[model samples]
Target chain A: MKRKKLRRAEDLFFTWVMRACLMTAAVVLGLILFVIFWRGIGALSWEMVSQPPSGGFYLSQGGGGVFHAIVGSLYLAAGATLLASLIAVPVVLYIHVYSPNGRLANNLRLALDIMWGIPSIVYGAFGFALMIYLGMRASLLAGIITLALVVLPILARTFDEVVSMAPRHLHETTFSLGSTRLEFLGVLLRQTVPGLLTAVLLAFGRGIGDAASVLFTAGFTNNMPEGLLRPVASLPLAVFFQLGTPFPEVQARAYASALILTVIILTISILAQLSISRLGRHVIR
Target chain B: MEATPDTTIRPLPAKKIAASRLSRWRWFKDAGARTMLGATAVIICLLIVVITAALTARSWPILSAYPLAELLTGQVWQPMRGLFGFAPFIAGSVAVTLVAMAFAVVPAVFSGMYLAEYTSSRTRSALKPLIDLLVGIPSVVYGLWGVLFIVPLVRDHIGPLSDRTLGQFFPFFARTNPSGYGLLAAGFVLAVMVFPLIVAVTEEVLRSIPREMRETLLALGATRWETTRCIMRRAALSGTLAAIVLGFSRAFGETLAVMMLIGNTPRIPSSLFDAAYSLPALIANNYGEIMSVPLYESALMGAALLLLIVVLGFNVMARLVIMRLTKRS
Candidate 1:
């Protein structure tokens, strides 16, 4: 009886310890969110969001905002998303429709998995090399191309899973109806549209929030993005530069930029989740 | 149905139907998609190849100038002085990654076990989303948080406490200056950043174990702790190892957070308190000014090449382990 009681006590202790471990993660996340919001709220203002940085902005004299960074991030991410989609959609369709369960498809999946694991910094290095070879300086177009390469594998793999989730019978039924392969693909695309959109948004979220991948290719500028040939500033770089300075106000701006980045990521994540559920209703297991 | 059958007595001409189906637009539509998709696949493969080729080509100048052995084994890394030994950076990378893994492994394992074996569905649902959010949070945000909170906390609290308590016995804990912008700070941030990935992967591994095995262990009078620690954990050992490796790869390749918090001094740290430099951090920190010097770009590219090779090696090994585990279970 005494031994039984001791075992029970040990079990209770173990359970509580595990609970605490789980709670620690939650607490850390909560703490990060709280710290960012608390530190950044004061620095946020209308002019800060709407206007570009004025002269001597990095000195933390507080005469500038993050409009240029925001616009640049959006433009780069949007352009990359569009380019990635053009490649990813066809690749996904080809794997699932044209050559299902073939060696090419399997190899493609493996390649994408490997590519997905490559660090963003490596992509930046590769992009830098390419830009040098092409006699191109840092420009919006360069950044877009680099980001597209970074996100293509990600978008392709995600859409592959989404397309694969359609019931096998759906494909069989379309083919059995004497419809052409193109029509069958059209039906499949319609069925997975929500998931495809979610995948694109997720890739966009990743592209915009990333810093290392674009650090070399984009080349920061204080002005708004003027043309495809000109350099563009992004939020992640802005945060990095601002925080690196010795001035306190610049650090505050960094926090505010982080806050904006966090919001964008969270919003994208929530949207992705919502779309998954909506797609679930349409998907036939 | 009977009316349609009677109407079908007058059939359409086969030649006309064939001609319509074989129209240029239809044939083009049918063939165009395959060509487009095939081209896209080729592009995907070509992109990966191009990246590899570009890194190698850019790195060749330095690689050809300096022997690989010297670069890997030399001590110093002064670019301006033309001394480009990557040993310090390599050691720094390994040290910080090991420190982060040391801090992160226990909590990640326990959290994974809790989620996999103990939690109710409701609690799991609530908690999983939060963990997923952690994975989505950008590294820059982690860096910002580290600078704002972790650096000060470590410098003010942990650094002093460690110096007074453990510094005497273990040199690893000793601090000369204790500014807290060093391996310990970087490790803490990396630990937090990688915790979610480790937990997620481990939880999946544990959950893959058959329910029957778990029930049989419990029926044989094993406690829940024994069942999980002895039976389930052993079964998933390879997978857990893979998870650890995956987390390590992430820590090794991490750039922004480490750069921000690691007090980017290129030295081989003797204690956790000393500042260090990592390959990725070095590349990111110097890429902007790299073009000023003749061979500086090549040297940085060499570092990047080393990082890429190491990260890719780890990823391939982890994927293989995962594949084997999946086959087993």
Candidate 2:
């Protein structure tokens, strides 16, 4: 009886500890979401959403909405994702279907893995130097191109995994049918569409969340992006630049902005997860 | 095996057409495929080379202009007057990372241990998404929280508590600021940021330990904690350290949140409350406005190279540790 009581006490201790840790994580997440929403809801007026931030950040008055930032972020992220996807798909397909030896493939994979270790700030510095040399001067083209470079390795690595999952029989069957290179590519592309979409969305999520890489390359301009070479503001940069000021209202607005950005990313990540599972179901079926 | 005279696809000579279509397309067997694959490998390798070259080119100008002694030992960072000492940035990065790791490692390991060894599948499944959500939130958002909430709360609450505790033990803790968004606060937030990575990797490593080992240990009447602490943890030590190092790398490279929270003053932090500068932040804030051309740019790249070296060093060390562990095990 005494031993049983001791065992029960120990179990109780363990359970409570686990519960406390989970609860702490939940609380931190909740607190961030709550503060963002609570402060941001009032700041998220239609005008704020529609107009651009003016010369100065004003919470209640003239500095307008996040329209340019929203549009710029979407355009740049979309452009980067599209470019990265296009480049990665072909390379990944070549690696998956045509590569003869494993040694070269292993080296490529390690190179991509090491790319992840390089800091975003370093990427920004590189991009900044290149942009100045190319005379892009903090334009949209500079920003989008830099973003594309930053996300290229990530997209390639993810797509390589997704493409490698294509069944060997599919390739052999296509070969047996004497499909041309283009025809084989079409077939492989059709099969990997869902996985590729997931990879793109994941890339998009990453692009959206990135800030430091964009700051030096994509100079913040209040005006909406007009051409491929115009300056633009992104959500991360907007939040980052605004958070350090003395204005409480501007600070609160930053919170709301962050919340919105996180929600968008969270939605994309969930969608990617869902698509992968959906792809699994299709495979099983 | 001569080609047919009426071959429709291409008007080739009989000898050229003698090769089967399969052999023609067999790039893997043919030199063409080998060349293409080899070229692809070269392209990937070139990207690494280009990035390294870019970093080197960027740093070269600055390093040439500034002597090594001044860059390494100098404290003041006046870009206008052409004086840039990166020692304080290095110190700040080390300070924040160490404090963050301290805050994050203990709880992260314990929680990871419990999740892996103690929790039921249902709980694990339900709790995992929540943890993932924490991980997915962007670092800038963390900075926002640090600024608006954490700073105030720490200033109003934590500082007093620290003051009272340190009042008995140390004089340094007495002159604390309420702004919790200093080195300690940034570290705390970073700990949260890296918690999921450590927990996930550590849990994965722990779970890979054979179930029978746990059962065998338990069959000897050891308590769950005893089994976990002694057998599972010991076995998974390499993985745990790797996870921690991975967390360290992530924290080290993290820029936006750390930049926003760590008050961007270029002073050596005597106390946690004093504003600090990190390498990434220093580059981010000044890279755009660098006036001395190569000198400032090189300093920034050198800082990046420094940060890169730290992360890569950790990665290499972790790999070595895991290799050693595997050999011994």
Candidate 3:
């Protein structure tokens, strides 16, 4: 009876410690959200979204905004997502439809898994080296290409999972009907459309939020991205550069940019989750 | 061409029959789609190869100019003086990663255990999304938080407290400058950044344990704590180790946040309060300025190559361990 009581007490202690760990994680996340919103809310405005920073805006007081950065980020992320999707979709389709259980398919998946774990900084270095060798300057093109590389593996892997979850009988039936491989791929695509969108959105979120990968390649500019060869500013870099200044207003703007970035990411994540559930309902098994 | 009566009836024309056969063959033989996707797959594989080759070719100048030992082991990293040693940054990276792991592991493991063993399905579902969101938060935002909140708190409170309490005996906490930007602050931010990843991996590891094992322990009159401590913990040990290794790789390659908080000084830090540089930080900080100098770009590329090799090695080992665990489970 005494030993039983001691065990009960130990169990209670273990449970409480675990609860505290959960509480700590929740509190840290809450603190981050609270701090960012509190610091940035006052500086967010329509004018801040519409106007670009004037000269000496980092140091001097002025009514300026991150319009350039916002536009540049959108363009860069959109371009990267498009490029990644163009390559990743075909690869995933090939794996799922053409060679579902082949050695080549498995090896490809493994390679992508490794690529997924690579650090963004290495991607940046690779992009930078390639640019120098090709005599290309820091421009929107360079940033897009680098970001595409970063997002490609993620998009491909996610899409592969979605495609694999498709009912096997669906493929067998289509093949039994004497459908061409392309037509069969078309059917699979229809089944996984929601999942494909979620993968693209997730990739877009990653591409937009990343800073280290594009820091050297993008080469920040004050103006919006005018052409493929022109330099572009992004939200992450904007926050980095603005916060480095010694001015209060600029720092506030940096927080606002971070707030913007956070909201975008949050929205994408929520959408992705919703689509996953929606797609789950479509799964036969 | 047969003009007999049965042939003249011509139930089906030879050309029409040939067309149907060709269509049937088209269903099974899709050379166009096959080649297209096969080429796309090849391109995907080539990306990794190209990146490795590019990094190697760019780093060749530095590798040839300076011996590998000298580049890796030399203490000073004075670029202007043509000294390109990576020892300080490498040490800094390892130290910061170790400190970050130290802060993150306990809480992560506990939380993971709670979610896996103690919590209801509803509670687990509710907390899982929150953790996922935390993982999605940008590193730049984390860096901003570090600069604004963590740095000040460390400088004003933790640094002074450490100095007063541990200064007499421990040299690691003895020299506190109160600058707030050093190894400790960087580690704290990194811990926060990597917390979600560790939690996710650990929870997965714990969840993969067979229910029969837990039931056996409970049936033996073991309390919940005893069952977890004696049986489940041992079962999931390898997975938890793999989780820690994966998180360490993440912390090691982290850049912007560490750069903001680590003070970016090129020296081996003797104390947690001292400033230090990391490999990624070094590359990010110097890439713009090094373009004007001759072997400087090569040296930076060399540092990047070293980082890539180290991270890849860790990732491969972690992958193998996880694969083994999954196979066993």
Candidate 4:
């Protein structure tokens, strides 16, 4: 009876410890999101969204909005997404249909895997060097190219997987019926358009959220983007530079900005996941 | 021709010629697509060459002027005056990473093990998505959080500890005001930023352990903890280690959060309260500010090259470990 009681006590203790671990994990995730949202929403306002950031807080001097940063972030993300998709889609399609043989396909896949493994900072360095060499000083075009390079591997890999998993019989039948390569591509692309869009959205989310690579190449400028070749501010960069200072209201604004950025990223990720599952369900059915 | 045998043949001008022309064109298009595919395969490889060339070209001036030892071993990083030793950045990067990893690994791995080995299916479903949300949160957001909530707490509490301990002797510790923008704060924020990744990867590895082993251990009258320790944990050690390494790499490469939180002061961390810098942070801060045809430019590029090499080295090592494990498994 004594031994059994001891064993039971030990088991109960371990179980409770394990339960606490689980609880902590859940709480950690919850707290991170909650803190961001709580602090961020408190500082957010229409005026804050409409004007460019200036020197003082809203409660005191009516601090400016993140309008320029938002626009710049959107422009850069869109530009990078467009460039990456333009490069990745054709490459992914070719790898899927034309390069079914071992050497070409395997090499491409390995290149992408390596690229994915490469750090974002390296991409920034390369971008800075390349841009400087080309006589472009911290320009938006440089930022776009840098982000596009970093995202290319991710887009290609995801698109390639989706396109390959697409109905093979459709391709075989089209080929046997003497349809041209372009026709086959058109049909396959139409079928996989949603999946490809999801890939682009994921890349856009990553690009917009990324700050380090953009920091060197994008160079935080407060002015609105005059053109593709000019420097511009971004949401991530603004939060990064502003949050480190000693002011309370500035910090609050930073929280709001951070909250906005996180929301955008989370929304895109959730949407991507939903589309992936939807695609999976379609394939299964 | 066989179809024509069934009825009166319709007259056509050069039917064989048209078929041949069509086949030739189809072949050409196929060939073109194949060529495009091959070109895509070469693109990344080509990028590797381009980057290497650009970096080496930029570093030529500094390398020609200074010996390799001075560049690696010198203490100061005065790029404007042609001094280009990145030891401070290197030390700062290492110290911050070490502290962050120390804070992150234990809690993350324990949580992962608990989730994988202890939790029920319903619980998993409810909690897993929440954990993923942590991973999806942007680094900039984490930076903001650190700046606002965490920095103040550190400043008010932990910063005083350093002041109390080393108040008389060390000037650096005396300067330990509760700014929350220092190495410790950055390290904690990095720990938070990387926590989800470590937990998720470690959990997946732990979950992959076969149930039969655990069942057998349990049937032998071992408790759940005993079963996990003797069977599941032992089996997943290498995988857990790999997850740790991967997490380390993520923390190492994290630039935005660390740069923002870590007071970008290029000095060795004399105390936990002291501020420090990191390689990626330094690059991000100075790369834009440096001008062309200057020693600062070369030094920055050189540091960047070194950082790139280090990150690449870690990735290669991680991949190698993964490959060996795969072969063994």
Candidate 4 chain A least-lDDT 10 residues: A276-285
Q: What's the TM-score of each model vs. the native?
A: 0.92, 0.86, 0.92, 0.83
Q: Score chain B of each candidate by TM-score.
A: 0.87, 0.83, 0.88, 0.80
Docking quality of model 2: it rates as acceptable
Mark the regions of model 2 whose C-alpha exceeds 4 Å error after superposition: A1-16, A54-63, A98-101, A160-191, B1-38, B67-69, B114-123, B207-227, B292-294, B319-329
Report the lDDT of model 1 for residue B297. 97
Locate the minimum summed-lDDT window of 10 residues in model 1 chain B. Answer: B6-15
For residues B179-283, write the lDDT of model 3, one tens digit per residue: 889999899989988888788778877877788999999999988888888754588888888788878888999988899899998889889888888999999
Better of 2 and 4 by lDDT: 4
Task: Report the error of model 4 at residue B243, Å.
Answer: 2.5
Report lDDT (Cα) of residue B197, candidate 3: 74
Against the native complex, each candidate's DockQ, computed on alpha carbons, is 0.48, 0.44, 0.53, 0.43
List all candidate RMSDs to the true structure.
5.8, 6.3, 6.9, 7.1
List the lowest-lDDT window of 10 residues for candidate 1 chain A.
A175-184
Top lDDT hit: 1
lDDT of candidate 1 over A1-285, digit per residue (tens): 998888778777888888898888889999999988888888887777889999988897749799999999999999999999987887788778877867678668767867877889999999999899999999999999999988888799889988988887787777666555566678888888988988898899889988898999999999999999999999999999999899988888888888888888899888888887776686656
Return the TM-score for chain B, candidate 4: 0.80
**Model 4: per-residue Cα lDDT over A1-285, one tens digit each:** 898778778877877776776577677667777888988899888876788866654343556878788888988889998998988898777766655645667667656755766668878888988887788888788999999988888788878877877876777666666666555776778788878977887788878887777888887776778887789899988776666566777767778788778878888888877876675554421
**Top DockQ prediction, candidate number:** 3
